[model samples]
Target: MPNHTLVNNIDHKDTKIITERSAAYGDDIWFTQTFPAEYRSVQAYYPIFFTKDENTGRFFSVALFGFQQNENLFIKDNRWSVPYIPLTHARTPFLIGEQALMEDGIEKHQRVLFLDEDHPRVNTEQGEPLFLEFGANAPYLESMADMMEVLHHGIEDHNAFIDMLVELELLESFTLDVELNDRSQHQMLGFYTINEDKLAALSSEVIAKLHQNGHLQPIYMTLASQSNVTRLIQLKNAQLGL
Candidate 1:
């Protein structure tokens, strides 16, 4: 279970978060949730794919890190091998939470930063400090706040983006079967990708709508990112010494 609490300097003034990237800090993840705004950067190094939540059936984008569950091929020597790490993974132990606020005598809910006290990254000493002398936020904490803000808006837009894809019936089931340099075979199931054929069949008017609404670029980016699967396979083969 997670013990998450609102990050207050008064209560957690001496707390420090592990800035190091390692499996101990929960960095051994095969994929992380991503958004359309990040496809350009994320697609460059990792294969972008869509997955659904079995409980809610909500579609979400992810950046792949490995071929199998809980395998992060990018981690070596306690470091992330890739230059670009997904924001969702980098923001571990801290997430945006809703809180009530009073403004102009009106009560409203707003997103606030919350830290998981029980997470492996949280500790009384070592790594980045959450606060400085006189209880001011540390530089890393300020960056996390900015990241949470961007993630909040990005996720809000992702819902509409998914809705548009559903309306257009552009999502289609996909399966990836691969044989590494070794004799081992792997099959990936229960994932979805953009239907290029259906995308090409869209009428000009609809295509223009997607283009004007900033969805077209991400669609193409996703398509382009499929090429990076070859890179991922190579990484896997290297890991297997195949």
Candidate 2:
């Protein structure tokens, strides 16, 4: 799984919607200041972590399903919120309210949730935490197989997923208008230029390998709305000069 690095400053915008993996537990909380009506996707199924602990052989997992946002500006109970707001959307366990925190001294940051140290159940033989995790959207701009490669393993070996291109026939291409986090935006950042020469050079040995492995396609798309995710991938692939 892709390892995560601390993003010290918010202005840098270094973080992308990524799939992270680790053997130890972690506490990473992200908050949103603006909630547009069209963007309820803030509550997408957050990718959880799976860590194996040899000390206790127990599988433990937790998911949040509710949200509570506090907008009361007058009292301590509502200090964490912006102020004078109504809780319009709270479908899942995503609580939008501001919670209390200890006063250390100088630097301060938001605290979302704290996980327990020990597992409740331990297997008779060994003590370990069996971890299992699932994420829907394949949040990468490259090819689908390439996307999985980077997510599961930090580096990708292109030779593995190359066969997917055989089944990936010619699909019409189009231009997209992308709006950046800043007011600036770009339209048609690039185009999907497929190499017919590469397709024609397929060898019999390569064909046999592809037949054995079977064809694969993307399971999930990652656009604001997934409707244009495939198209976006093609655009990115073209821009990359692949």
Candidate 3:
């Protein structure tokens, strides 16, 4: 469970967040949520795939880091090897929360910053400080807030993009079977990818609409990212000494 609390300078002036990438800090994730705006940078380093939420049955995009659970191939020597870290992963130990406030006799909802008090990265003695001596947000905290803002809107865009893809019947289920150099086999299931056949068959008018909506490029980027699976397999083989 997460001990979530609203961040206030008075109560958390000495709080610090460890920004290092390491499994000890809970960075050993196999995949993380991503959005179309990040597809260009993400496609270069990881394979982009769509995954469905079990309870809601809604699809969302993810960038795969490894073949199995808790196996993040990007973490080496306590560092994330990729140049571009997904926003969801970059904003760690911090989350955006909505607070209802009354402004001029009107009730309004505002996004507020919340931190996980029990997270390993949270401490009072080390890493980036959350607040300065005068009780103002530190530079690191500002950056995290900005990241959270982007993530908040990006998720909305991601959902809309997925809905468009679904309406167009452009997503297809896929299963990947991999045989490592040492003959070790791994199978990936319950993932979806862009259906190139369906996309190619779409009318030019539909393609124009996708282009106008700024989603066409990301669609191609997702397809191009499939090549990274081979790179991922090589990384896995290297790990196995195969």
Top candidate on lDDT is 3
lDDT of 2 at 73: 15
**What lDDT does the true structure give each of the candidates?**
0.90, 0.26, 0.93
Which runs of model 1 end up more than 4 angstroms from their true locations?
Answer: none
TM-scores for every candidate against the unseen true structure? 0.97, 0.20, 0.97
Model 2, span 1-242: residue lDDT tens: 22222212222123222112111211111212212221233223221111122476322111111111221111222122222211211111112222355677655545231112132221223222122123222222123323232223311222233225425542223354554334344454222322335544667786566556532211111122234334333333443454
Clashes of 2: 20
**Cα error of candidate 2 at position 47, Å:** 17
lDDT of 3 by residue, 1-242 (tens): 99999999988989998888898999999999899988999999999999999999999999999999999988888888879999888888999999999999999999999999999999998899989999988999899899899999998888889989999999999998989999888899999999999999999999999999988999999999999999899889888887
- Model 1: weakest 10-residue lDDT segment is 19-28
Worst 10 residues of 2 by lDDT: 59-68
Per model, how many backbone clashes are there?
0, 20, 0
